[model samples]
Target: MATEPAPISFARGAPSLDIIDTEGLRAAADRAFTTDPAGTFAYGTSVGYKPLRAWIAERHGVSENQVLVTNGSMQADAFLFETLVSAGDTVVVERPSYDRTLLSLKGRQADLRALELEEDGVNVRAFADLLAGGTDVRLAHLIPNFQNPAGYSLSGDKRRALVALAREYDVTIFEDDPYVELRFSGESQPTMLSLSTSGEVVYASSFSKTVCPGIRVGYLVGDEDLIAKIAKLATGTYISPNMVAQSIVNEFVRGGSFETSIATVKTALAERAARLADGLRAQIPDARFVDPEGGYFLWVEFPEGTDGDALFDAAAARGLAIVKGSDFLLDGAKNSIRIAYSGVTPDEIDEGVTRLAQAYASL
Candidate 1:
């Protein structure tokens, strides 16, 4: 058998943290060892490190009591699901959504309902109709800003309406907003959590995008009582997130380098996104895609009769890798694919798109 070549991947979503300030980490570690060596090494509260919690709260314009740090946003979702979802319970999610979220709910045996996504956001009218038609929705998981696999942001009006619908239906809304700060274009939009009136939104975000994914720090902001319950669940799970990582992030934030770091990452991501988009448009004119205002992905739809899975295989055969859109959907859509531009450089973007064009040609 002929040996296969290593695949060039456009499937990663996290930032390339090679350029992050290593000196900051050293300083933070020095502070941790000098001031509270015992605390740094010992297990701490599950609610997350105090200073990190305070920093997150201040950033989001919430109180520390409203925040609960988890191992990552994925853990935060699991904790919330464990606390809120029962077997046979119904939850609404975008049609093409995060695969991990779908897996998490499926593992818990929740009835997953799909809502179609429009260019401006989730179809609010369809969602409202579902609620009106008596969909027993217990919760709705939404990615309001630069949605995964779709690369579309919910408009402010739609966001407010979605929040209102959740309030009217008396259902909790999980605003999974890990990509809100990664915007490379367009004006900022209001978060679903900010528009929600009934405190029905559980807002989650992470440092995995703007900072190093290895830090594994993410947080949930919601009703204090609900947050407290999730914190308890987290306490039982990992006891708490890594205290050393939390302290490093907290010190970075306090030293006023957090904003600078974010700016640096955003600049690089914007350049990469532009490179990917332009390369795709030039190389594959038949491919249709929405230019994402933020986030690392561009969601592309091939011409009808195109098989994304076949394209995936073809691309992989040519030493390139891309994710088929069906993987992100509860009910598979066979025509689309998600291309992530965060990890690859401009040359890689060009080469990857060129390979993808060849794949499409083969199909």
Candidate 2:
């Protein structure tokens, strides 16, 4: 008899659709149809829908002129790179950062220099030294809160220091803060934009992590002049993001459901994070992980000499798939793996961690 495999998944970063608010979509549709159906369907200005921009500014404490809504933060990054990065231009990034950021910059033929990431944040002295030595660096991108694979938040002091370094070096800082609002525990840190009054920080965030990923709504906030430049590029590229989707998000946030939805998702993610951490501790005693205060990932570092690729294969064989840390690094970090707990239920976390333990033991 052929037996079916166990159904356990931890691979994706998307939110479960079951919790998404379709009713908000209906309301948005109604408003669009009733108020200005033709306008909704027509080509929008590349600067994005005006009301959505205003909403974003209000939500993030920036002016509407500073906000340029894009298809998603991924697109936001693309636009920024396209506008700012010349071929062979040097950029600073955190090692083991988001893979997509690496791919985007590489696509532009930009030279990416990675700074070693510490648990608290990127090492300040090393970062300062790079700038102080004048390393032809054009831009520095950082995910300050609940960073992707590392799942570490930058302390307030470090955040300020990094910004100061950027100012000292006359380099632009791309503060990629997609996971800032996902905090399940701990205090929220001040954003680089909040700290910098000179418009040196270009901030990007998304609704994919908090709301439905399908909404495909994210935005960038920066100097009005820089944002206008991005808007020109956006006009040539995407024309404009889905107006209907923007309206949906606007309606959701305005109706107060967005806040409620955030609270709901946070509660579930907190439980899953706790469950996974507990299971990892019990099942793989040798595995070391920093339990994230927020966001969807638990970064587990296996003992030195453990083969991350082999462990990945073994876990996949047991119907549990996870991303090895080496995949996140530009220079290859082979002893860690990023386990995302956001997409799975609490029970699934337990099962996945148990299978991961078995795979680690076998290795």
Candidate 3:
């Protein structure tokens, strides 16, 4: 009997556990033990820990009342749809976006209007047309920084234009920004939250990427009044979020370990991204891709005639897991593939690509 090699996954947008700060987490546990363990374990504010909220508010330059803690950023995303979207309501999204978000929106019965993604971000002209077509758009959800699956960031000009368009069309922009802090290189862009004068944008981010995945602490920031609406929804749902995790994150942020952890992951991911990009170029000369500035993805286009699904299956059979790009789109991308590089090491990336190249060759 032949045993398959353990698969090297290039699927999930997972940060490497290799560099995660276990010591900082241990320190947080210690603080929790001393500072009232029972209270830490008990139900706390649905708005999240005051200190954590305060820290996030200060970091993003919003008011504390404008921030609500969530089980994770995805839960915040769910609440956003619940608060704003009704059945058959129109929601705008990037053509190839984070699949989970698309699924969530579909679950909400949202009429998803997808804009074609460009290297700089969404196709602004197409976006304008979508707006001009007179759909009663309830939300325009996006990943403006180091976008998931696509790995493209919105330009400042486009960001301003999109926000203005949202304002013109009376659409709220839901900015899912889990990857903004992971930039290994390049200057930062202005957030949609910073651009909105009318509070048309709701910003969500998680510590799962930078700090630790299991911490499960993330937040939603908007105007105090809007945040109050979200918080009300939170109370009805789970009574409140996990206070112990909140305490741990609050302790971590206060102690200044979060940024250090971020830098560590960024360094490793940057190296892996470069390695994958180079390896693909060497091993599969026809593979088309853009090397990402940050985040876990590198979007690849196979030879025109190749079937991405077949390639994925072949790769899996060869013990290398990669996502078919069509999974991220509403229509389909039969020849497109998305490879996540941050979760695995440089060596694993090399081995994964070797298998991937072999799979592509066999196909």
Best by TM-score: 3
| Per-residue alpha-carbon lDDT of candidate 2 for residues 67-130, written as tens digits (9 for 90 to 100) | 9988888999999999999999999899889989988898899999998888888888988888
lDDT of 3 by residue, 158-177 (tens): 99998999889888999899
Model 2 pairs in collision? none
**Predictions: Cα RMSD each:** 1.9, 1.5, 1.3
Residue pairs in candidate 3 whose N, alpha carbon or C atoms collide under 3 angstroms: none
- Per-residue CA lDDT of model 1 for 1-363, tens digit only, reads 288655678987766655466666677668766777666677889998887898888877888999998777898898999999999999999979988999999999999989998889898898899899998999999998889878899898998898888888998999999988888689898888878766889999988876668888888999999988888888777787888887777777787667777787788878888888898889899889887788888899988888888999989888898889999998757999998888887778888888888888888
> How many residue pairs clash in all the candidates, one count each?
1, 0, 0
Q: What lDDT does each candidate get?
A: 0.85, 0.86, 0.88
Which regions of candidate 1 deviate over 4 angstroms? 1-6, 35-38
- Give model 1's TM-score versus the native structure: 0.95
Model 3's alpha-carbon lDDT is: 0.88
Clashing pairs in model 1?
183-294
